[model samples]
Target: MFLVGLTGGIATGKSTVSCMVKDMGVPVVDADLIARQIVEPGRRAWKKIREVFGDEVFLDSGEIDRPKLGAIVFSDIEKRRALNKITHPDIYSEIRGQVFKHFLRGEQFVVLDLPLLYESNRVSSYLYKTIVVSCDDELQLERLLERNQFTEKEAIARIEAQMPLDRKCQLADIIIENSGSIAETRKQVEGIIKLLRSSNHHIYNRVFYGGIFIVVLTAIAMLMYWIFMR
Candidate 1:
């Protein structure tokens, strides 16, 4: 099975595309979901975060106050890096496991929904293809404001914190322009799905592994024949 990496800037409709893919019965290993799971109340990542950021970032219910933590990290590069350092390893480990499960299930391809696919840059090398979902900056800003209820300054800061959408598009094997209507976006996603389904990566991998298995079996038979002759 081959792996596809799906990414986009904040509020660029990556999640929307991800949901579309999921609805189509494609396996998607979502890193954002894994990140949240890893940091749940008493998880190792949660413990590390509480240790580093202190009790202030936790709510009265002992859950991490995401907004409070986000406010802290988004403004400070070092703190952001520290947070990533604490959580990333766990997140990646879980993502890898999920991908492996899909592979064992003999999926044709799996999509990894990673918000930081470009920024992290670690998993891209393993992906058969990378897709970037993007919109115009104005539309992106407008969406962020509406969805997150953030002031213009806060929305812009959040947008500026990640790798630029243009740079991500430049790196992508496919670009889904989400600035248009939902139907237009769905059409783009369907086209991408068809393209990925038609790919020869999975076929090539099966052929390659089958050849290796045959070679190993032949070598074993030859060794057994030699032993019998002796």
Candidate 2:
């Protein structure tokens, strides 16, 4: 199986590209969606967040008020780190399980759509390719403000919190310039999908085997340590 990572800045049309990919019959495991799911009221992440952030972050219905939580975490670096520390492990575990399921099923390809893929450094040791969707900076700010109704300060803070778009563009294996019409963006996505379908999967196979070897070796090392110490 081939795994591809899709990422972009907030409100940068990453979801749009992801949707286009899904429409092509490819499986997409969206990190954002998984994040939301893992934080549902009764979930461990939600419980921990409420314990840390307290009742202020929750609504009357007991759901986590995302805007309230965002306002808190986005403005405070330490708080953001704390939040990530609590949630990232579970989110990554779920994503890994989903990807492995597809891999074991012999899927031709799968997409992991993550907004913070670069920030989290989720590229290497997995993923055959990465695509960063981007638009004009001014346009991105406008879209964010309109979509979230955030003040300029709030919007800018959120955007700045992640790795800069230019840096991600430099690092990405492919760039989907989404500064134009939806049709244009869709066309670009189609072209990329076509290429991926035709591309060789040897690199992906090597990564999988390498990962398995590492896991097996680690288990053997642990067993040896236990035997010697005991």
Top TM-score: which candidate number? 1
State each model's C-alpha RMSD to the native: 3.1, 4.1
Q: What are the per-residue Cα lDDT tens digits for candidate 1 across 1-230?
A: 88899999999999999999999999999988899899999899999999999999999999999999998998899999999999999999999899878878999999999999989888988889999999999999999999999889889889999999999999999999999999999999999999889888998887887799899999999999999998
Scored by CA lDDT, what does every candidate get? 0.94, 0.92
lDDT of 2 by residue, 89-131 (tens): 9899999999889877778889999888888885554778999
Check candidate 1 and list the clashing pairs. Answer: none
Candidate 2 residue spans exceeding 4 A from truth: 202-230
What TM-score fits each model? 0.91, 0.89
Which 10-residue span in candidate 2 carries the lowest summed lDDT?
A: 118-127
**Clash totals, every prediction:** 0, 0
